[model samples]
Target chain A: MSAVLTKDIVKTFADVNAVDGISLAVPDGEFMVLLGPSGCGKTTFLRIICGLERQTTGDILIGGTVVNDIPPRARGVAMMFQSYGLYPHYKIRDNIAFPLRTQRVARAEIENKVEWASNLLGIGHLLDRRPRQLSGGERQRVALARALVREPTVLLLDEPLSNLDAKLRASARNEIKQFQQRVGTTTIYVTHDQVEAMGMGDRIAVIDHGRVRQVGTPTAIYDDPADRFVATFVGTPPMNLVAWNGGHLGFRPENFLPRELIDDSAVTEFSFRVDRSEYLGSERIVYGVLEGLESVQEITAKLPPAHVDQESIRPGEWHAFAVRNSALCYFDKDGKRAIRH
Target chain B: MPRPLAAAIREVSFYSAVLFFVVIAAFPFYWMVITAFKTNSDLYTLTNIPFWFNEAPTLAHIKYLFTQTLFARWLLNSLIIGVCVVAITLVTALPAGYSLARMTGRSGETLGIGIFMTYLVPPTLLFLPLSRVISMLGLQDSMWSLVLVYPTFTIPFCTWLLMGFFKAVPREIEEAAVVDGCSILGAFIKMVLPVSVPAILTVVIFTFTLTLQEFVYALTFISSSAQKTITLGVATDLVRGDIYFWGELMAGALIAAIPVAIAYNLFLDRFIAGITGGAVK
Candidate 1:
């Protein structure tokens, strides 16, 4: 097992800094995800690690050897690109065999490895087909077969599942995670999809605007985000954040419920109107402005769809909601996580 | 009139117009081919009907073309020059275009547009100084002079064409190849170049034709009969002063057109795609 490490990588294009100083370490066999929105510099960080783009200042190490001056081909890492990057003119077998051929591996060994990889990817039957002939999912597997055949110490995937349909993306995510675990290779995956990151990463690094906001296990980051950005960025319906107590108070919508539903153990309570409601089969989200500060703030509370008549939660009514103090996350002046238990 | 009659009349008139234009377009080529095979005696006769094959077709004009003049030598000179131009243009343009497309960013685009502007600089204006440069190289009568000079125009256009083509290939593919153990140059040869066949063929055909038929420089710098290209030699050597040897001239012209026509037919799909796709993409 080979660990991958980056020490303070930074990249700038023209006057705009793309990847701010970022230092990360992926333990041997760990699957780490650099999660961020587009233009947030996650891809730039991955490119820097691969030596495809020179960092303005940094040190990169794979398998304990410094690789700052190494070219991408010699860096001992393979990346599956967002585009799948199969050679359009070559068949799947040749695409998978390319890296080995470049390394001057003997023809017989190259064929063996190509076969092994295609089998591992469940794409052995598609070897004779060109990339343009394969469906998106098959093309994706071919790309993975190409990447894995090299068996580099570290594997980098840049939004590899982004092009798949939603259902296929979920399955591909599972495939990638299981594959990484089985191979036990240090893998760094980059994606803007929070769900994919949380589902596949052994640890997720939340990044925004070229900086890493927080890095931790998915559960830890979800339960205890390191900053306001992470709290809002990691969860679906994103943690509902609002101006409060001279800082920012945040609570997941699920934690905000009808006043009667919250017990005496609730730490904070508010009177807000439910002007809009969305029933999501399993639950209902009631949205409205906070009472008295109606013009200044709004809040949404999620409840079981059975709790109230659908019409009662409709627009033009006021309702009260409360939050369990434990579920609240507070960020200070600069949006850094500062809540204390 | 019944609707069927009206429709028939409209269809007939439309096809007639199409046939009229088609004949107008094809007549010269038809005339040239027949003239190439006609004897000088048959060609000069005033009483013979011109449209159909009335005389026994002879290869006399073509035979004279090969034997009486340096037409063979000129054709050979053109072939050599065309090959050199294609080689130099591809070697220089593919890498220059890739670098401009991948490395230079906004500056590369500006520089590329600037280089294309140099190609837009008419060769008629540059021939005088280029002639001086050729003479300075001690290549006053050398066909190598044309080989060296043709790229001055060929490279800029080829580079522009290739830059459009290379840029059209998504950068991720190249990056993936790099990650899969290829150096920048290795990726270019193994991946980028192979997928770029249409554009490469376009560059080859474009430069080859341009170099073969280019006359001003060939006429000005190359005075040696042996060094003149087919286009220059046939027009100058085949005619004595003012009289045109229609049979021989048409034969030479037809021969010159054959290779280009065959080349276009061979890569017709790629040629059209390269023209429309690379430029727009």
Candidate 2:
């Protein structure tokens, strides 16, 4: 296994810069996830790293070799396409063995590895079946088996779990994570699903509009977002942002506690007008517009479901909530993080 | 009329209409087969005699076709030319179609349309100048003349046909193959071509039929009896200044139609799939 590194990569399609100058360094055996919304160039970045797409200007070094000019096969990168591009014509065994066959591995060794991978993914009995005969989860396992069977320097997955159903997506996500750890193969997975990124990556790179907006551990991205976009995009119920004293203040929904929880007057407080509230089993999520703000902006506040007194709060009513100063993240007018003295 | 009887009557009329069309379509094929089996007196009764046949069903016409004439040689020439045309069309069109389907630039559709337009130009218009070029190369009066001339039509049409089929294949499958250590050409061979079996079969049948049935170029370029294809031989050699060899000619026509009919029936489903492109998905 080797660390994959990109130096100032830029990909321009005619006049549109699909991937702006972005540099990334994925350590050996690390699970690096590129996360973004659709058309955000996360897939493009992953494709460049796999050599399926060429960068207009950059160097991709896989295992310390500049692989910018090398083809994908020579680069020793095996990618599992988002659709689990299992060859429809090939049996499961052959699909998993394709990369090894291309590498000209001996027949005995190829069979041994194919068997090992199929069994590892709990799909050994499916070896004789065509991809069309298998379910989506089975196809995903076959795709993963094919990618890892060759034992490449890097494994690339493009939204691999997105095809599975919701129930399967969670389990498959964990399986992929555990599989990557077991093999200790350096993997770069691309997904538009933040929960996948949050749950799967050793570190996540949040991408937007052909640029890396933030790269950090999942907890850091959740707790200390670099800017307003990351603050709002990375959290569930999303982070609430409002203009306060000429600065944009960002706070997580969970960080907005009932007024009794905060004893300090120095903390930021909001008279949140409750527009609606949802009772999730663990948390009571209250969504509303903050009172006394000239410009209209909505906010969400999370409370313990045990403490959700149904008689005390209702829709179109104002509620007292306070945000601890430490919990407040400030961003400048341009949405860049602001450090207050 | 009562409702049930009226419904039955409608069904009967519908079947009769279908039967009428079927008879109109099938009568000529029946006439060819019956003529091939008829004795000399049976054919002389008249060309228009309805349900015509004689008491005797003779194999004499078939015997004359195989023994008395160079019909076998003409059949072999046609077979050789048809196979060569298919091979050449495949060699040129598969790659050209792949390139057209996978082309990244804006001109891909334009170039594809331009190539298809060449197929629309009448072969009758081309044979005039093509025969001169054929004789210039000293390939005149040989089956090679037709072999060389046929792909000029086949390649363009096959390329256009296969382009649509190749485009129907998902780009991700090829990209996946590329990442699995296949070169672009390797991806096309191992993945694209195998997935395109139906379209390839369609192209084979089309090129086979075209070269076999093409009469103008074959007759115009090759005047020697030894070099004549089946179509040219049946139409020209069997008619000696309007003295038609009715039985032998029909026998030759019947034999030629058999292989094409069998091939179509064998690949009818696949041919439909190739045109519709819904087999795999």
Candidate 3:
């Protein structure tokens, strides 16, 4: 019942449109991630839904009620800020109990709910300490505990993992995903990191320039991007777009492989001259320029360490590379996806 | 000089500079204490080494101050005025400061500077005009006039200070509170105020001390002996036109000054932090 729906949400600051006409729906218990580069209006859109920022013209509905006029607290939503924003003077128990206390929840019930939320987040032992005393990861969990204590209909998180170091980020990501699944509250997470979106989101909405380019599962966003922007933005070393046929031919780095390795009968061939290669512990990314194209377009091939031996690919040498016909994506002159014949 | 000797000379000069300033600062208190306890004859004698008691120290002047003068009354008057002014400053400045800090764009900064400009106006120049207002209110000889006047300066300065302190507090904290179900004012009270203890403490101390030390308006507004504040009473009551009661005056000053001195020392670091406002952590 706690689904969130927004209709044509737009927020303008002065002459600039920070969020331009974003309409989205989050079904109950779904983990939706708004993914974009920095300054891409993803965060602004999330804030609009949370009621922290009012959209210039839009209707926001939470649980079938149009909540455009409702304030954040009345809308039954909780947001975790980028900085965690834990009250420095309050003990961890009091921090978790704050939202409940504001609503005049009875003292005994407040204590019970605080204990439940803290224990759920595995932070029961740290409840007596203040926020300044905790580590970054511990503080993040405390923020999560405080947000969850209210049992709000929708949970909004704004780049909560961006503050954590890389080693802790993966584990924290797992904990959050598992916690959401267990709790089953509709969640909207905003992040600029595509890897996080791919690993964690039930669905990812790729946005740019205050507009949503596409919204789909991570696989759909990755393998079947709707346009050139989504194709280039979602992957690392991004989807390689080479000039072809008055438009561009796009394929993922992993899909563009040595002709010897791609065993598929229907595949497109290229004379890829190796410019350089990077040996990443698990895979080697080979950077090269393709021959027979009028313009020298740079592209990369991701080779698994087991499949490609070291010293086999060297600079100044040419190799035959192929992409499976199905994996090849065609874009018209306007950069929109065109049907492949 | 040899390397070790050169280092020794540098250390000696540094300690000497520190000791020189300490003595310069401590000498006034030393003179005040000795004069307060010294016998009048011993204090006045030209032949006796004035640094120490030439005669036995006695409580005669201290007794005279208590019995012959309204020293205790003046202390009580100061306390009442200090408390009242501090309360008014807090009630007015805390909200004024919070609003100015939260206000967006160039206008808040401009308005804050406008408010602070009032604090820079000299009290000596202000007291003349203020006395006219005092007489119009029929508060000519009442200490309540001081309670009303001290905040004219205290509120402006304290508001400017508190504004800076509140601005340094992360906006996310208040925003988080609003999302957690508190109204904006509720967020300020529960979240903003608790974390702002050092700045609030700074404001309290600054307002209290300023009220304690103020003399101009206190002297202008109150003419009767019974209504006089400590600063005005101590400076005027212990002096006869041609002769000065150095012992009684120093005793009054010593008693009045000790608390303020101790307070400054106690909260000096936090006071500096509050004034800077950006270095809350």
Winner by lDDT: 3
DockQ of 2: 0.83
Model 1 CA lDDT for position B33: 96
Chain A of model 3, TM-score against the native? 0.97
Write one digit per residue (lDDT tens) for candidate 1, span A1-341.
Answer: 34888888889898788988898888888999999989999998999998888999878888899999999999889988998888998888999999998899999999999999988889999989899999999999998888889798888899999899999988988998899888887899999998988899999998898988888999999999998888888877778777766678788888887778876674688777777888889988777777644222357777788876686566887766788898888888688888562
Which residue pairs collide in model 3, if any? none
The 10 consecutive residues of candidate 1 chain A with the worst lDDT sum are: A291-300
Real A-B contacts recovered, model 1 = 0.84
- What CA root-mean-square deviation does each model show from the true structure? 2.3, 2.0, 1.9
Q: What TM-score do all the candidates reach, one by one?
A: 0.95, 0.96, 0.96
Off by over 4 Å in 2: A263-266, A294-297, B1-10, B46-49, B278-281
lDDT of each: 0.87, 0.89, 0.91
Q: How well is each residue in A230-323 modelled by candidate 2, as lDDT tens digits? A: 8888988788888866768888888897788777887877788888888888888888888776322568888887776666778888878899
Colliding residue pairs in candidate 1: none
TM-score of chain B of each: 0.93, 0.95, 0.95
Q: Candidate 2 has which clashing residue pairs, if any?
A: none
Between candidates 1 and 2, the DockQ winner: 2
Residue A52 CA displacement from its true place in model 1, Å = 0.8
